[model samples]
Structure formats: C-alpha cells, structure tokens
Target: MFYMSSGNDIPIDPDGSSSPIPDIDLSSILGNTLLIGIAIVVIAAPVVGFMAWEPVEEGNVKVVKKWGAASGTVFEPGAHFINPVSQSTVSLSTRPQAYTMSSQQGDGNRENTDDAITVLTEDGLRVDIDITIRYRVDSAEAVNFYKNYRGTDAAEQRLIRPSIRSVLRTEAGRLPVTEIYTGEGQTKLKAAAQETLQQDFNEDGLILETVQIRNVNLPQEYAQSVEQKEITKQRKQQKENELEVEKLEADRKRIEAEGQAEANRILSESLDQNVLTEKYIEKLNETDTVYIPVGGEGYPQFVRNIEGGSGQNSGQNTAQSTNSGSTNQSAA
Candidate 1:
C-alpha cells in the first residue's frame, strides 16, 4: 500500500507486508540539490572574472574602452583590473617600426617605386623623391592616441604614410630644383620634413624615430643635357690649357733667336769690318774652293780672288820670319 501523511490505504501491491520504508529521505535530496547549485556557481565565477578585465604586458599598452567606445585613459604595461561586464582592451606595441619606400632612376619609368613627393627647385624644375620613416607609439600617451585615432597597427601605417607624404610634398615644393640636386638643399629638405612630421605626429601623440631620403629623380632629357654641358666645359678647359702651353713655347723660341742674333752682332762690332775681312781671307786660303755672294757688279768675286792670293803670301812670309829668328838664336 502507498501511504501519504494523511494515508488512507490505497493498495500499491497485493503482497504488501507493510514494512514502513523510511518515507522518502527528504534530507538527502535537499543536500544533493544544494551541492549541484554550488558546482555551477564555482565554474561560472572564474570565466566571468577573467572576461571582466585583463592586464597589459611589459613594453606594451592596453587601450581600454567601454565595449565599442574608447576610454580617455591609456593603461601602461602592468597589472590592471576592469569591470568584467562593460570594458574591452586593445594592445599596442611600444617598439619602433620601419617603413622603406623604393627609389626610381633617371628615366620617368618607376621601378620598385612607391608613393613619392614631388619637389620644385629654385630653377623651377620638378623632382620626385622617395622616403623611409621609422617610428613608434609612445605608451604613456597610447590611450589618448587610440581615442584620437582608433584601430590597430594597420591604422598606424595608414595614418603615418599619408602624414609623411604630405609633409614631404610641402617641404619639397618650397625648395628650388638646383638646391635639391646640389648644395645644402637636401639637408635642409630632410630637416624641414622631419620637423613638420615630428610636430604633427607629436601633437597626435605619435613618437617619431627617424627619417631618410632614398632617391631623387629628374627627367631623362635634363640629365642628358647636363652631362653634355659638363663634357663641353671640360673640353674647352683642355683647349685653353694647350693654347697657354703653345704661347709659352713660342715666346721662349723667339727670345732664344733674338739672344743669338745680338751675340753675333756684338762680336762683329768688337772685331771691326777689317777683322772680318781678314778672317774671311784666311778661311779662303785654307780651303780649295772659295765662294762669296756677288754684290755690286763683280766686286765680290774680285775681292775673293785678291783676299785668297794675299792670305797665301802673308802666311809664307810669317813662316820664313819665324824660321830665321830660330836659326839666329841657335848661332848666338
């Protein structure tokens, strides 16, 4: 028989001996329900605790927000606690990142070239220049940065490239083409770009590390013209040098010829005309053939014969006088 607290006796089995089975153990059932409830709470508490908030690591910052919306405060690397229900975090790197842009050559064709800034020279020439930039996010200001410019590192790349390009273009436009190609123009351009970029990024709480100029390209036709002009200038200089050397050599030869003529004239004057005539007569006597330029109607030919005959006689007379003096001395 099944019996309730107000039991009347409804027979559950015909062979009922009615042993009074301990009524339904109410304490045990209640204890089991309580244990199950505790287990559920234990498992759920940790999951909720972790989701509510997390910590930022070393050399990093967590940009926290109330779900989709940003919070003004940036959290530096270290332990932090947040509401498990309301906030989420985005991590940003504090280390510097490098961006390299390729350069082009003399031809207008760009090879491995990226977006570049065009600059004008003092002479109103246009030149394209490539740039490289290295930078990072300052962790202390990271939270403000996120609020101002939200997103990931990809967002940083987007923001920085455009900013650099803008600054470069502005600076390049202010410079003259001649200065960019030569002189201190390149240095000034780099400094100007750097200063502008740093100022803008700093205002936005971005850290600027380095800036570089990769390539500067001009028109092919202009390049060729410059080369030709340089070559012509060099050739003209070489010709001028050669002319100077030739002038010096000609002057030296003229001076030498004039000196020799002066010496001959002086010697002729020292000896007198008679001495020159006597020397000519002596030379004619010593040679088998005597020739002289005929001038004034046969006078030169007549003088030549007379000089030759007189020179021979005087030589014979002088030899005889010398021989006679020697013989007299020996007798004495």
Candidate 2:
C-alpha cells in the first residue's frame, strides 16, 4: 500500500489499500502570528545561546562559580564564554575603594547617618572619629578570597570594617585625648591604624593603599577646656615675651649708661691741671677784652695787650706828671 503525495507516491503498507489522511495546515489552525513567532525563536536560539559569553568591565575581575561554590575559574576584563546554567560570574572590583566612617550623611559606603567610629581615649573622654581606608581586592588571590569570604561585600563587611575599628580603637586607647586631637601624635595614630589594617587586609587578599584620619571630634566639654587652656597658654607666652623685651631694653640701657660713664672717666683723666690751664688761656684769646679781671695766680691784676697795635686792647690814656720836669709815675 502507498499514499499519494502532491507530486509523488509514498509507500505506507505492503499488502493493504492506500488511505490518504487529510493534512490540515498548521498556519491556518494556529494563525500566522504564532507561526512567525515560532520561526523567529528558532532562528534566534543560536544567537541567544551567546548569553554564555559574559563581558567584564575595566578594573574588575569576574569569578565564575559552579553550583553554589567558587569554581576556581577567574575571568579578567573583556568578553568570556561561560556556561549559562551551571556556571555564573561574580564580579569583584580590583580598583581602589574606600570604606569611610563618617558623621556626615551619605558620605561613605553606608547609608545610615552618623556612622563615625566612637571610642574612648586613655583619658576616658569619648571621641568620635571620621576615617577613610583605601584598598583593592588582589585579583591574583581572588579565588582564595572568595573561597573564604564568598564575595567582596561579605569580605568587607566581615573583615575590613571590624579590623579598622579594632585597630584604630586599640591604638587610640593608648594615647590621651590631648595627644590624639592633633599634631605629631595624631599622625602616629594614623600610622598605627594603617599598619595593622594593612596586615589584616593582606591576610584576606586585599591590598591596603592608605588610611586617612580625617577628623577627631572630642567631647564638647573637652574641646571647651582645651580652648581655654590654649588661651591661657597664649597669654602666658605673651607675658613672657613682654618680660623678655623689657629685659632686653634694660640691658641696652645698662650698656648705654656704662658707655657714658666710661666716656666721662676718660675725659676726666685727660684733663690735668696743665690741660685746664691751657684750655683757660686758649679761651681768653677769643674775647674782646685784652685783660682778665682775675689772673692765673688767683691775684686781682689787670694786664693790657703787650702789642699795642690792637687799638681796642691798648688804652688811649698814658701816665702823666702834674709838675714839669719831674720824672715820676702817676697812679689813678
């Protein structure tokens, strides 16, 4: 037996009469839209199969996990073909990231407000600190990191956050609030936190880049006290500076007085009796009168000019006798 096709005959049975079954058109029964939809899906199946190929972004590494666990397969940045069903990628960023503990809203990885680190100093004053730690996942050991911590978020939440607070608090408790507030001591605190956190991050396949102690906020009472103390210290320094200036002035005055006394002593030593007499004689030459009232010998004798050429010094009157031919000196 055989069946008749549109253009040929097809055999069905060997010793029976041929029966032709009616072939209903699938497009007529299911409609053209459904048929077109089936054809599109059939054609697009191979293209959609490319979902196995995952593209990684820059500064990131993708860890392909099998089942629910890490498969030790890591993919670097760019397109990679991965199994769609059993295998998937967990992207881990190798770029620098920061975990900041701050008081300001939305300033850190956290969403809640006022998440700054609060701890006590050696002096027992409560301190709230704002700090930021920079680090990156070591891509080489990313598999091992995921094996232990499962993911980057879990690693950060479990290890890095707690380690930062622990190391910072431990270091801070060693110093008093005054030292921890600023200056070289504050620098030391940052260094200590960085060192310890570095080790902790290294153990978890994370590279610690930097640790920044942005702000150290002390209690209000302590801040006010410190301000008052600073004010007093400034006043004390001002007073000391004034005293130093006064001491320097006194030293200068003393030096001037000593110089003046030395000058007077030298002048007195230079002037002997002969020097005094010479100075007094020299002084008499500049005057209008030719004779002095007092003589050098302390006697009251007046002497006119020896050279009579100066008319002012020489007197017009000469000694005269009243009687003629009498050789006598007259006295007035």
The C-alpha RMSD in Å for every predicted model, in order, reads 11.6, 10.7
Error of 2 at 161 (Å): 2.2
For model 2, residues 43-142, the per-residue Cα lDDT tens digits are: 9878777768799999999888888688888899988887787888888889998888898879877877898888889988789888998888999988
lDDT of 1: 0.69
Each candidate structure's TM-score, on Cα atoms with residue i matched to residue i, is: 0.55, 0.60
Which window of 10 residues has the lowest lDDT sum in candidate 2?
Answer: 317-326
Error of 2 at 302 (Å): 23
Candidate 1 lowest-lDDT run of ten: 104-113
As for candidate 1, its clashing pairs are 52-84, 121-176, 121-177, 122-176, 122-177
Q: What is the lDDT of residue 312 in candidate 2?
A: 33
After aligning candidate 2 to the native by TM-score, how far in Å is the CA of 152 from where it should be?
A: 3.5
lDDT for each candidate structure = 0.69, 0.77
